[model samples]
Every structure is written in structure tokens, then in C-alpha cells.
Target: MNTSLKLKLGLLVFLLVLSVVTIVPSFYSATPDWWKKYMAPEGLRLGLDLQGGMHLVLKVDLKKAEENSLELAANDLKDTLSEQSVSAIRTPSVSPDTVIFTLPNTSSIEQVKKLVAEDFPDIDTKIESQEGSFPRIILTLKDAKKDYIKKHSVDQSLEIIRNRIDQFGVAEPVIIRQGEDEIVIQLPGVKDPKRAMKLLGDTAQLEFKLVAEPAGLNLNELIEKAKKSGQWKDGEDLKKLNRALQNQLPSDTTISFEKEVDPQTKVERITPLLLENKTLMTGEMVKDAQVRIGGTFNEPYVSLDLTGRGGKVFGQLTEKNVGRRMAIVLDNNVRSAPVIRERILGGSAQISGTFTHEEASDLAIVLRVGALPAPVDIIQNMTVGASLGQDSINKGLTSGVFGTIMVIGF
Candidate 1:
């Protein structure tokens, strides 16, 4: 052979050897200890059509999604009314479709109507009752918004799931909307499908609610009352405690507990806290969340970049509620309830905790995907074998190897 041809043959032989070394573990069930330690130990990952994998059919809770959206709107409406200096009070009972807050009088009625017309066009406003001087103004989501919510929920779920898979290093996942309120996902070559599902199907709700100060009691006193309650056995019956103290709590507030176990004693301590119904902000307001090494300790934290509107809202919330405890809530549990010492403006915030790099990265991913309130019911979850058959896959692999060999021979 000429010098150039000899060089080409050598290069081809090197590539073939490298391929064989890398793919050896995939072809054989058991690989040599030396090969595994020195060569590619992961082997080749086959596609869904070639290897067995997990398949899932998810049903989106459309109605629940609408309810969550309405809840958020009600909170925002309360904030807007407060901003406008409009006095209002909550009703005894509220429905998911309606926001019942007593306006001062008929004079404020027109202002609220005008506000809804201009600001919240998706909500239809009306006076449910004009008893006494104050009118009970009701705002319901329009049919158009109800329809939009269904569509929006599906789209949002798909985006969040895709973002999660991409972050966690899943390759070639087939995620698509199946129907009006369903999604079909085929995760190829996922060894631990349930773990992957847990990662993708987390419906954790993130909210910023002001820790409550009951009419006659402060936070300290509330915790004391909880500690002395009948449900304080072992400090685990949070629901029972809530039921025991529900009548004593102020309206539009609920108690949540955070559990901490002492490493030395192995004893658990339950810390009870009260949070209000109005969410000043939520994950939707977070434009992006990233893991960063900052602060005085140079530890890992999740840094949040808020949207323009969210920043303004957050600033106002902190400014108006100075000296009050604002809780960073996740799934109805308080992560941290810090005192709002100063009026924090700007669009940036930080979730500070003693977190390892992995924990912080996972939290960043969660925040980035946003808190998807719409719960997903896995209607179908099963492992599926290759539709193309093992024989076909082997044949395709053989064809590819042979084609490479033929090219090198030429």
C-alpha cells in the first residue's frame, strides 16, 4: 500500500478497536473486571424501539388546575384592591369560581367593576348581594378563561416535564399531548422508571404567604398553644392539631408544621406556624432559578430572578409588611419564615439554606420548572419491550458494523 492508504487503514482500525472496546459490555451480559474498570462501563443505551423501557400515560387534573389559577387570581385581586385603597372583607364561604369580598358601598362597586373591566378582563364581576351599605362583589372566571385554563394546563405540564428530563440527562424522551387533558410519555432505557416519574411528576406548590398573627395572639403564643394542645402527642398529628385549634385561629389562615429531628438524640421536634390564604407570590413569578455559590459562607444557594411584575409585587409585599414573618412555603409547609427587615426592591432573591451541591442543583431545577399545581394521575405505567424485536436490532447493528468495515476496505 501507498503511504496515504496505509495511514487511512491505520486510522480506521483504531476507530474499530475503540468501538469494540466501548460496546463490549452491551453485547455481553457480564464484562471483565479489568475492562469495566478501564473501559466504558455504562455500555450502549438502546432506544425504545430496540430495548424494553417504561411507558406512561398521565391525566392532567384540569378542574384542579382551574381552581388553582382562580385561587391565585383571588389573591392578586385582593392585592390590587389594597393597592387602590379599596376596603374589602372576605365572605363566610367562598367558591372556586367566585371571589366574594364585601366592598365598602355602592360607590366602591363602580370602581371595582371598572378595575375588573380594565385589568382582569377574563373575570366577570358582579354584586352578589347589596345587603347593608357594603356590597358583596363576586368575580367569576369567564367561560373563555375556563377553556383557556384547560389548554394552558396541558401545555405548562408538557414544558415542565420536558425541562425536568433535559436537566436530569434523559435522552430521546417522547413526550406529547395525547388528548384534551392527557399526556403520553415514553422514556427509553430508563433503568429506574419510578424514580424518573417522581422527578417529573412532582406537583409541589411553591407560595410566599405571610406568616399569620391571629387577632388576639402572636406567633410565639400560637406555637405555645399548639404545644399545650391535646394533639401534641409525639408532635406528629399536625392535622389533628389544626382541627383542635381551627376555631381559635383567625379566618383565612391555617396552621402548618415543620419537623426537625435532632441528630444526637434522635428525637423529633415539630414547629407549628400559621400562614395566610393570600399568596403574595408564587413560582410562576420566578423567571429563572440557578444554583450559585455566594453569601458570606460561600455556600450553595438557589438564586431566583423574578419577572418585572413579580419584582414590583414582591417589593410592595415586603414594604407593606415590615417586621412581619414571610414564609417561603412549599407544598403547604414552611421552608423558612424570615422577618422582612427592610424593603427589598429589584428583581433578585435568594433561597438560603445549608445545602450541598446536589441538593441545591435539584432545588434549582424545581424552581426553574415552576410549581405545577396541576396534579398528574398516572393512568398507565408499565415496562414495554422493544417493538422492533431484538433480532431486528441485532441485524441493524450488524449492518452498521459491516458498512464501516466495507468503507475501510475500499
Candidate 2:
């Protein structure tokens, strides 16, 4: 061969070898030990449709997040007025986007308007009504502010879900914000689709609240009353229970439930518990969390290590309420309510529940990463099986082979 021809042929052979080496792993499930040691370890990641996995579309509850934000703002307004020596006759009533409060006099109303204008510029205040001698003022969250909250909630949910998926060790996940309030996630080659779905769907909102002293009122009695009034059933839904006890619940307390499935009856039961709404700490201050087995029963539990500030705050909380019971709440469900049992320092805590190893691990993962900004509902869940995915691969390969053969013949 001529020298130029020889050089061209050698270059072509080298290129072909490199291409085959890079592409071989994609076709084969298990490569030779030598190949893995020398060649690139990564292969082409197939999509959910090709590899068979879980596809989910989640809708972010931006409205609830907005209402929560407004409620916090209303509480802050009340605190600010109290600090300014203008005491509101009653606690501010928070609606979808408005906070309504009654002041003792018109002077207090002017002071509130001035304070809100200066500090809470995103809220517009108006005279709502006059009750006896008190003037009720309404502080409506501005439209622009509400829109911002909704947009931010969606974006925050997307990031939190992405972080969770990354921690779950999905090789290549497709997590994207689909629309104004929807998130799309695709997990390829997920061995446990149900586990993945549960991990993705959990809101993981963790809170530490002091259990109400005297326990407010017996929620079972309230439930029974509702049942007698035809407002509840034997297994009443959470929304109906909340509505039934809305006025009966103490102003400073809220109601949550612990869910358990009877082993014998196989029926799910929710036991209601009254808890103070004031959160002493939240998962936002969590530094790290890990799954650990209890020394006694080998039961799985989540151990938490809080941030420096969190430790100080927690220490103070425990120290002040040494004899009280504090509830560990997740997603409005009371997981445990244990007596403070003296001051707990060092910022270390444990969450013990009826959890399997996998459940505990997933809980630790979410807590380590952080809670979702807003709750999410799975609007769509589609699982593709391995057999279907293999079929797809087979058809793609057959087509490719035929195309290659035709090209060679031509």
C-alpha cells in the first residue's frame, strides 16, 4: 500500500476500535472485568420508556403554601402590633390571602396601617367593619406577592424533589418543572416502584411541637359527636374531622392523627391527637440524619443531628418544658409524643416509628436533604415493566440490524 493510504487505513482502524469500545457497554448488561477496569465505566442511560421505570406527574399545592405564608404574616403582624403597645382585641383571622383583625380604637387602626405600610408593603390594609367600639381592618396579600409565592413554591418543590431523587441513587433521573404547578419525574430501572413512589410523594414536613396540656379535648368524643350528627362516619376523613372540630379546637392547639393498620382486621385506623400549633423546631434546621437500628429490638429509627443554632434552640426548649410532652410531627401526623424527660442537649434526637429498614432510610434521606417547600399530590403514576422495556430494545435492535444490512448490500 502507498504510505498515504496506509496512514488513512490505520487512522480508520483506530477510530473504529474507539467507537466500539465506547458503545459496547450500552448493549451488554455485564462487561468483562478487564473491560470495566480499563474502559469507561458509564453506559448510555435509557429513558423510562426504554428501561422500564416509574413515571410520575406531581401537582404542587401552591394554594396551601400561600395560605400558610399569609397565616405566618398575620401572626407576625399581631406580634409587631403587640410590641408597639397596640394590642389587637382578638387574634388575626387568616383567610386565603387576607388577615382580618379588630383593634380597640381608630388610633390603633391608623397605627396598624402605618406599620403595615412601612414593614409589610406587600399587604394592602382596608377597614373591614366596626364591631361595637372596635374597628376591624383587613390586610389583603397583594396579587403580585401571591403570584410570587405560587411561582416560588413550584420551583422549590422541583428542587426538593430533585434532591430527593439524587439521594435515592437513581442513575439518571428526569426531574423537571412541567407547567405552572406541575412537576414531571422519570426514574429509569427502578427495582421498587412502590418505594420510589412513596419516597417521591412524601412531603417530609417535620416539626417538633409541645403536646397540649390537659390534651385540649378528647378527639374521639368529637369524632363520635360528628358521627351522631351525620357529619362523620366510622372512618371519618381528615378534612371532615377538621371541619367538625374547627370551632371546638383551642386557639393555640391543632389536631393531628397517628395512623395504624390493625394486623388482625387489616383496617386502617387514625387516632387523633391535640397538639400545640407552635413549632419549637423544624427540619429546616436539621444538619444531618441517618438510619440506625435500636440496640434493644433491632428496630429501625431515624437519628437526627441539628445545626448549631438548632441545638441551642432545642436545648432551651427542652430545658423550659422538662415535664411536658413534645410531639414529633411529620406531614401533620404525630409520629411520637414523649415526655421531655429532663433537658435534652447536644442537638441529637431520634424518631422511632413502626418503620422497616427501607422506610427509615428513605426518611433519613429526605430529612438530611430538607423538607419540600409545598405539599405535592401524585396526579399520574405510570410504571413500565422490564419485559416491555426488553421488547422495545429488541425491536430497536432488529430495525438497526436491518438498516445496517441494507446499507452494506447497497
Candidate 3:
């Protein structure tokens, strides 16, 4: 062989080897997860048409998502103000597109002006001068702040919903924001569409609240008090009470009405065991949950394992309040009222209920998913069968082979 030709052949061989080393791994990583069942990494994507699976176009309710975000922000703001000894009048039964509040008499007007500007920069407020001896603060969004709230709030909402879905334990879910205000959730091989919807659609914000026994206080009277004071909406009151029970209290204690002792009694008015604004527990500290059998039966119940801080808190609470009933409230509804039989210092606890194994597992899944910062609206869902996925793989392979053949022929 001529010297130049020999060099050319050597260079070509080296390049071929390099391509095999680099390109092969690229192909492996690019393999569709669905295709992994057949062979491992044959590369490329599977289309819905070829797969014969469901194709869904989800319309993201941007407005709803934004509202959810605002609601969360409002809650956070309310909590913050309450913690600072600044009371906020409960949000009126009006559209969430606009939220309003009244400041407590103890609140400093000048301090509020600075705090409102600093704390809730997104919340544009217009403060009225001492109008007839009563100085009032009006909160409404300016154009720029409204725009900011819309986009950022939607993004945060999408992230939270995505986290919720991923934690659903589905093998390979495709959850992505389709547009500025929309999300696309694809659950391949999901057998139960209804279950998936139920899990995802629920806005579960678990809170631990000290119960307050209405005692002699009439339900109608408390309702009227909530209405008249303008400082407490029923829902807000419920959430606030739960948050107090979960984490805000100084001592690791919880208070529930002695009435909750009878599991059979569904309707009972029981006061929470602890003081207001005290949180003995929160879902944020829970690391994971599973359906497990208790020491008693093969009967199913949810086993909770707390994160480090949560474990410490749970242990302390259990140790301090050994004889009290802790209210396990989910979205303001009591799920279980379990007594502190003993101090649980192991960083794990189980919630027993009138639940089947499946129900326990489902509840476990929900707890494992963590609480969302705000609510979520499921705009769309698509499920792909295994057969359809296989068909997609075959069609994709055929197309690739034909394309390669044509390229070689050329």
C-alpha cells in the first residue's frame, strides 16, 4: 500500500473504534424506558400513534393554578402575620382572584406599611389614611405585581403538582408543563384511571390542630362569631387550628376532646388538647409511609416514618403527652384520633383506622407524597397499555431500519 493510503486506513480504523466507544453508550442512555423490556438500549423515542396508547392534550388551568398559588401565599402570609401578633381578618367569601384583609388594632400602621412592602412584595396594597378615626389597609394587586404573581405562581404550582405525581409510585410517568400555564401528565401502564385521578386531584394539606370544644358554645354562635369578627373564616379557622396542633405549640402536646375516644361516634364536638398557634406536627417532616400490619391484626394501617427533625418532634410530643389524644387531621377533617399509648421514640408511628389493606396503602401513598404548597387541578391524563407500547417499539424499529438501509444505499 502507498504510504498516504496506509495512513488514511489507520486513521479510519481509529475513528471507527472511537465512534464505537462513544456512540454506543449514547445509544444505551437514549433507549426508551419502555423499550428496556425487550432488549436494553436500542435508542430513540416511541410515538403515541405507533404505540396505540391514549393521547391526551391537557389544558392547564393557568387561572386556577395561579389562584392556588395565591391561596398558598395568602395562607403563608396569614400564618406569618399571626405569628407576629398581627391579626388578619379572614378572607371574605369572595373570588380568590382578589383577596382582602383587615389589620388588628394592635398592629402599627407605619410598621405594616413597611412590612407589607417588604414581606409580600407580590401583594400590592393601598393603605387608606385614618378614615373617620379608623385607619384601614386595602390590599389589591397592581398590574406589574399581578403579572409577576401569575407567572411565578403558576410555575410553583406546576413544580408542586409534578412532585405530587412523581411520588404517586408509578413506574414511568411523563409530567411536564406544556406551556406557560399548562401541564401534561402521562401515566403509562396505569391500570386504574379513576384511582390516579382521585390521588392527583385531591388537594390534601394535612395539618395538626388542637381541638377546641364548642362546649356550651353553639355551632350557630361560633359560625356567627366567625362571621362577625371578620377575623376567622370557617376554613381558615380550621386550617389555623390544625397548624397549631401540628407544630406551633411550645410543648410537644396535643389536645382533642375526650369525646373522640369512641371511634364509633362519628359526630362529636371535641376541643383540641393544646393552646392556639402551637404546631406539634406537620407532614413536611415525614420521610415515608407504608401500609403495614400492626401488632394486633393482619388488618392494614399506615406506618409513618418521620425525618430527623420530625422523629425528634414526634418523640418529644409522645413523651410529654403520654396520655392525651392527638388529632390527625387531613385538610381540616379528622382521620384518626389515636391516644399516646406510650412514648414513641423510634421515629416511626402507625395510624390505625377502619381501613382495608388497599385503603391503608392508598393513604400511605398520599402521606409519602408530602403536602403540596397549594391545590392542584388535573387538566388532563393519558394512559398507555403495554401492548400499545410494544407496537410503538416495533414500528419505530422498522422505520429506523428502513432509514438506515436508504442511507447506506445512497
Residue-level lDDT for 401 in candidate 3: 83
Task: Name the 10 consecutive residues with the lowest summed lDDT in model 3.
Answer: 251-260
Candidate with more favorable, higher lDDT: 1 or 3: 1
lDDT of candidate 1 over 111-222, digit per residue (tens): 8888878888788777855446667887778899999888688998888888887887777889999989888988887787766777777786778889887566665565
Question: Ranking under lDDT, best-scoring first?
Answer: 2, 1, 3
lDDT of 3 by residue, 191-238 (tens): 567776766655566655444433453444443454576644544645
Per-residue lDDT of 299 in model 1: 74
Error of 2 at 228 (Å): 2.7
Ranking by TM-score: 2, 1, 3
lDDT at 102, model 3: 65
CA lDDT of every candidate: 0.79, 0.82, 0.60
Ten residues in sequence with the least summed lDDT for candidate 2: 89-98
Candidate 2 lDDT tens digits, 1-410 = 89999999999899979878877888876878678567856757787777788888999998878777776677778778878898774443534566677787877767887888888877878885555567888777789988898879888888888898999999889888887899999899999988998888888989999987564567788878988898767555665666667788777576677776554466876777778766778898899999998845577889999999999999999999989888899887787788998998998999986777999999999998788777789999988777877798899889988997998799
Off by over 4 Å in 3: 1-61, 64-88, 91-93, 104-107, 129-134, 140-173, 217-282, 308-326, 331-333, 339-351, 372-374, 379-410
RMSD of 3: 9.4
